[model samples]
Target: MTSLSDLRRALAPQPGEAGTAGGSDRPPLVVALPEGRAASPRDLRGWETKAALAVGTSGSTGDPKVVLLSAAALVASAELTHARLGGPGTWLLALPTGHIAGVQVLVRSVVAGTEPGVMDLSTGFRASGFATAARAVLTRPGPHYTALVPTQLARLVATDGPGLAAIREFDAVLIGGAATPPSLLARARAAGVRVVTTYGMSETAGGCVYDGVPLDGVRLRLNDGRIEIAGPVLALGYQGGEPFGEWFRTGDLGRLTDGRLEVIGRADDVIISGGENVSPTEVERVLAAQPGVHEVCVVGVPDPEWGQAVAAAVVPTDPDTPPAEDDLAAAVRAAVGRCAAPKQVAYLPELPLKGPGKVDRAAVARTFG
Candidate 1:
C-alpha cells in the first residue's frame, strides 16, 4: 500500500500555485486529476485512460505499497454512500482532500451536482469554527452532510450551544478513521445529532459500511475470523502492480452476527499472553467506560515472560486532574476480567494521529518502545 506520507506529498501544491475555492485565506481545493490526463505524451499513455493516482498506506505494519483505485470505483463508492444516506446535497469539506475519505466527500458533492463548502484544514479543528463554517454553508438552504473523526466528534459533542447545535442541523455526520468512544456518540445523539459509524478504507474508495451492514452491492464475509471484502467498490489493484483477487483479504479480524459485521481488531493486534488471547479493542472498550478518559488505545508491548503484555495509552478528559493509573486499571478489571486489565497505563497529553483524527499506531508504539 502507498505510504500515507508520500500521498501527503502528492496533495502538496506546486510552488506559487494560488489556492482555489475560497481563495487566499483557505487551502487550495485539491482535485483528483481526471483519468487519461498526463503531463507528457510518452509517460505511459496506454495506462493513462485506466490508471489512477495511487495512495500509500501508512507503513504501520511494514513497507508501504501503492493501492490503485479506479476513478469508476470511487464514483461507485460515492453512489453507494449517497444511496444509503439519502440523496446527497452539499458537503462540508473539513478534511484534507488528499486522503480517500476526504476526496470522496468532494466527489460525492460534485457527482450530485452540488458545490461543496470548504473548510480550512491547515489550522487545527475547533468546535466553534465548525459551527461557523457549517452555518455559512447551509445558508443556501439544501440538505448537507459532514464527516468527522472521533477526536473532532468529541470536541463537537462537548460544546453546549453552538457546536452541538450545528451538528444537529446537519443531515448526517459520519464518524470513522477510528472507533468512536461510546460516551461521545451517546452524548452527541442525546443532543439530537444524526451520527453514523462508517467502516472501510482506500481500497473500497471510502466507507462502504454504515453502522454495521455493508452498503448497496457490497459483500462481506469472515475467512477464519478475518474480514474478506468483495464488491463493486473494490479497487482494481495497486500502483506497483499487486493485482486484486476476487476478494480483498483485510488484516482486520471480524465477525458476522445476524448479517451485521463487527470489527474485532487487527489479527496482528491479538496477543497470546499466558496462553490467553487478549484483544486490545476489548481492553479499549473497558477503559472508555472510566470517568476521565477522553481517548485511549491499548496495544501489546514486548514482555520477557508473557511474550507480549497488554499496555494502554490514554488521553484524559482534564489536563489538571487526570485519572489515577491504578484506578483506571481497576476499572478495566471490573468491566472485563482481571486478565484483560491493562498491565501498564501511560498518560498522554494527546494521541498522535494521521489524516483527520485516527490514532497513529506506529506513533504510539514509538513512544513506549
Candidate 2:
C-alpha cells in the first residue's frame, strides 16, 4: 500500500525546481478530502505518478480531512467518462487548477495527448471572461469539453450575448462540486447547453459517477442509509487513516434504487426541524427554481420553537431588484412544501463561496447564526 509520505515523495517536484519562478513546479495534485470532498493540492512532486487526486472537504457541513487516490484510479475514471461522453475531447481549464474537477480537466487532457486551453481564474469567474477566453481557445479547437460548478453554470446560462453563446458551443459541460439545483440545469438545457450533472469527489478521482450512473469499473451501494463506494476509482485512503480497500464509507446520505443514486445531502448537514427531517439540499433545490434567485444555500439556524429552523441565503439574478422574502418563501413552500421550506430568506449580493466557483456553506451558516 502507498503511504501518504510515499505519495508526497513520488510526486512533489525536485528540490532545485521547487522554487522556480512561475514554473510548473507546483503543478496541481488532485486530492479528495472528507470535508471538502475534492481539492487540488498545490504540490505535486510527491505524487508525479499518483494519478488519483484526494480533495479536502469544504467543511460547510463538518470538519475536513484528506482522502487518497491512485493514478490507475484516475485513468479508470477518465476512460469511463470518455466512453460515456462519446470520447475524450479537447478540454478547457476554466476552473482553478487546485480542485479535483479542475485537475481532472488537466489530467484528462494529458491522458488524451491534447493540450487544454487555460483560463485565468485570478479575477474570479466571470461570464464575459469565459466568453472571451473560450472564443480565443475555440478558434483552433476540435471537440471541446469543460467542467464547471453549479454556480458558474447558473451565471453563464443567465448571461446573454457571448456568455451563453460560448456555453452552447461546448460539446459537453460536466457540472458538479455541489448539488446542482434542478432549476439551474433546466435553464441551461433550455438555452441549448449540453450539461451533464456529475457525482463523485476526490476519493473517486474527480467524478466517477456521471449523471446518475457509475463510470466503468466503478460501483455504488447504500450501506446503513449512507452511500458506500468501491472499485478502482476509489481513493487509497485518508492521510493517516486505514488503508481503504473494498468499500470506502461516504458521509453522504443516499440510496440506490433501480441502479440510480439519489443524494440526500451529508448526514451531518441534515437538520431535524419541528419533528421533521429536512435536507438543506432539497430546500436549496426548490428555492433555486424561484425567479430572481440566481444562487442559493439553505442552512438550519437555532430556533427556540423548532430545534433548528431553516434559513436561506440567496444571490438574486438582478442586482438592482431583489425579491420579497414572503414571495420567495411561498415559492419554496409550493415547490418543496411548507413543511420543508425555509423559515427566513436573506438576500446577498453574492453567496460567500470559498475558492473559485464553490459555495462556502460554512460561511453561510455563520451569517445566519
Candidate 3:
C-alpha cells in the first residue's frame, strides 16, 4: 500500500498546466497510514481520479463516512488558509494525519515547499510533550503555525511554561473540530496566544472559515436557518456518489447578521420539551459558566409529561464534590429560562468523546438521558 509520505510524488507535475493535473482520469491515490482502523488500505479503483487523499471522519455526530477530496480541492483549501494566516512557512503536525486537519498540514507544507513537523500523538496529547515538539519547530526557519482542537488549546491555556509560550510564538494557531466556548478563546488570547477559531469539516477539506469569516472563493448561506456552504474546497462527495448538488447543506443551524454568521447548534440537536424548543447548546453554555461545572452536555429524554424532558450529563470540576443539581438548574434557568433548565442532572467523571474531541451526544443520551 502507498503511504501519505508519497503525497509529493502523487502530485508531481507531468505535462499539464498550473492548477490542473497532467492527465484526466488518472486513478485516485489513497494516502494510507501505517496504523489505525484504516491501516489496511485497499484499492478503490478510479475513486479519486484526480485526488490523492481519502480521509475518514471520526463521525462524532453519527455514522462515520469516508470523504473523497480532489487535488484541486486540497490545494485550494491550503492556499486560502495560507493567505489568511500569513504565507505558510512551517507547520507542526500536532493532530492525527489520518484526519483532514492533520492531512491538510502535510498538504500545506508540500505546497509551501517545506517539511511538516510531527509530534507523537499515540500516547495521548500532553502539554509537556507538546512543548518539546513546539520548541523544536520554533527554532526552524521562517514563520510557524499549528492546528488544534479546543480541548488541547484549553490545556495549553490553563498551564504555564514552555507549552503556553510555544503556542504563543506561532504566527497562527487554528482551533476547530468542535465548538469552542467563548471563555476559552478569551483566555487563550489573554495568555498571548494567536488563536483563530476555524469552522469547517472533512467535507470542506479542513477549515474554510477564519473566525466567522469565510475564506475567499467560499460562500455561506442560510436555508431556513440551516447552514449551506459553496466553495472551491468542497469535497467531491462522500464515497459511492452521495449525490451532492452545487451547495452542500450542512446539518448545523445558524443565523446571519450584518453578513456574518452565528452558528446556534445542530439542526437535529434542538429539543421540543413542554411545547418549547430548547437548544441544548444554549443550556450547556449557561451551565458550563456555573462554578464547579467543568464540561456539560444537555439532551432530551423521553418523558410522559413533557414528551421529552431536558436532561444534563455534566462533568464536574471536582468529582468528589459535584455541583448541586439545584444550583446547576438554577444557573441554566437564570441564563436561559426555566423551560430550558434541565430537569435531571447526571454528574460524571468526564464526558464521552468521539473521534477527536466532540462530545458523543448519542452515547450521552443512551447512558444518562
The number of the candidate with the highest lDDT is 3
Instruction: Please report the candidate that would top TM-score against the real structure.
Output: 3
TM-score for predicted model 3 compared with the true structure: 0.91
- Candidate 2 Cα deviation (angstroms), residue 200: 0.7
Q: Estimate candidate 3's alpha-carbon lDDT, on a 0 to 1 scale.
A: 0.80
**Can you tell me which runs of candidate 2 are displaced by over 4 Å?**
1-55, 334-337
C-alpha lDDT of residue 331 in model 1: 83
lDDT of 2 by residue, 1-369 (tens): 112333333234444443111133433343433323443454534333243355564454456566555656656677778888888778878877555677677667766667677777778788988888887657764678899998888778876778899989998999988888888888899999999988887777777777888887788888888998888777766665666779978889987878888898888888788888888888888778878778888888889999988899988888789877888778777877776778887788888876435678778888876
RMSD per candidate (Å) reads: 7.8, 6.7, 2.6
Candidate with more favorable, higher TM-score: 2 or 3: 3
Order of models, best lDDT first: 3, 2, 1
How big is the positional error of residue 100 in model 3, measured in Å on the Cα after superposition?
Answer: 0.9
Cα lDDT tens digits for candidate 3, 274-360: 999998878877887778876788889999999898999988778999999999888888888888989988888777877657788
The weakest ten consecutive residues by lDDT in model 3 span 32-41
The per-prediction tally of clashing pairs is 6, 32, 0
Better of 1 and 3 by TM-score: 3
Once superposed on the true structure, which residue ranges of model 3 sit more than 4 Å away at CA? 1-4, 17-28, 32-48
Quote each prediction's TM-score: 0.85, 0.83, 0.91
lDDT of 1 at 108: 76
